[model samples]
Target: MTKSQPYTQADLAKLGNVLIYLVDRLGPISKTKALKLIYLVQEVSVKTYGLPFFNMPFLVWRLGPVAEDVFVDLSAEEPVLLANYIQRQEEDCKTFIHASQPFSDDEFSDNEMEILALVAKTYGSLSAERLVEVIHRPHSLWYQTARENGVLDYLEQGRMTTTNFEIDFGRLLDDMPERKRMYTGQLDYLEQSRALKV
Candidate 1:
């Protein structure tokens, strides 16, 4: 969600584990959809826990937010972390990533596992088009980052640091309603935009 440090191998492994876990739950999914799921998990985790789940750097791409490192690895001939567990395929002319084997939840902490499960349950079923809409919501990290940087990579780790946000019970409770409205309004706007484009 925010500009974080480049991921280490272990981080990629943990992220790969989350990806595989989601693939198992949702079936083979498009790469774009997979990236959105990863972004959403990080976004929610950052807001709720004050620390991002994977510490992966994300950029504001034309499609929305993308973890370029993860994308490159998955597209590699032998993916760094997902080599044995994932396979890339083309179906109906669309690229998709499918799990080659079942995933184990051993690498993830209880909190990480909880967030992964929650994200998968809430968003795994959505189409990629819908995900882009949800992610571009007003006040979302993607929206803010894109507005500030245009299409450039998010390189402001200082601003994204947990220290920048003071998370308190009262603050969270107060912000929840506004966040809900932002999410709803963004979806409505996206639908209208899509209609206009069509």
Candidate 2:
């Protein structure tokens, strides 16, 4: 059966999301599987990559001629904040961007804390608003996804302000019933910190 040639926005989003998750858990990334994911998506040559697009799309697949995988440089060029990612998304109308800088510190709370930690080592520090932007992906499906994903219930003034992140953390620690397995996982992260020298 013949397969598709072009990659859809969702496919692109999927790759972007997966890469984002990988960056959160790991740090920095290699260009090795960049081509593999695209080829599997396009089914172009049973090894298709992707068309070169501007905005650096976080991914690239040089199908016909170059025959290579290309990834965008999500470098911090400058300190990135919530405004940075949000403004860029508003300008580009897409979430294909990646982080080019990283900073690790326990400067956040709630999902913001870990989310911040995850991106810290890759995207640097993000403002609560910027963190909200990442949490607001279309696939995230607000309201439902917010709670399911342990993102909502963390908002303050109906917005995910930094204060809300701390509030969420405090509330989670105080009210165990509302906590999810992810909450337990975060606790483990904190526990690990206690094991440290500093």
Query: If scored against the real structure, what TM-score would every candidate get?
Result: 0.69, 0.21
lDDT of 1: 0.65
After superposition of all CA atoms, the RMSD between model 2 and the true structure is 19.5
lDDT of 2 at 29: 36
TM-score of candidate 2 on Cα atoms, chains taken together: 0.21
Best candidate according to lDDT: 1
Candidate 1 stretches with Cα past 4 Å from truth are 1-7, 76-81, 150-198
Instruction: Name the lDDT value of residue 149 in candidate 2.
Output: 45
Residue 122 lDDT in candidate 1: 91
- What are the per-residue Cα lDDT tens digits for candidate 2 across 129-195? 3433543444322333345546555542344522111112222133344443444454455445434
Model 1, residue 24: what's the lDDT? 88
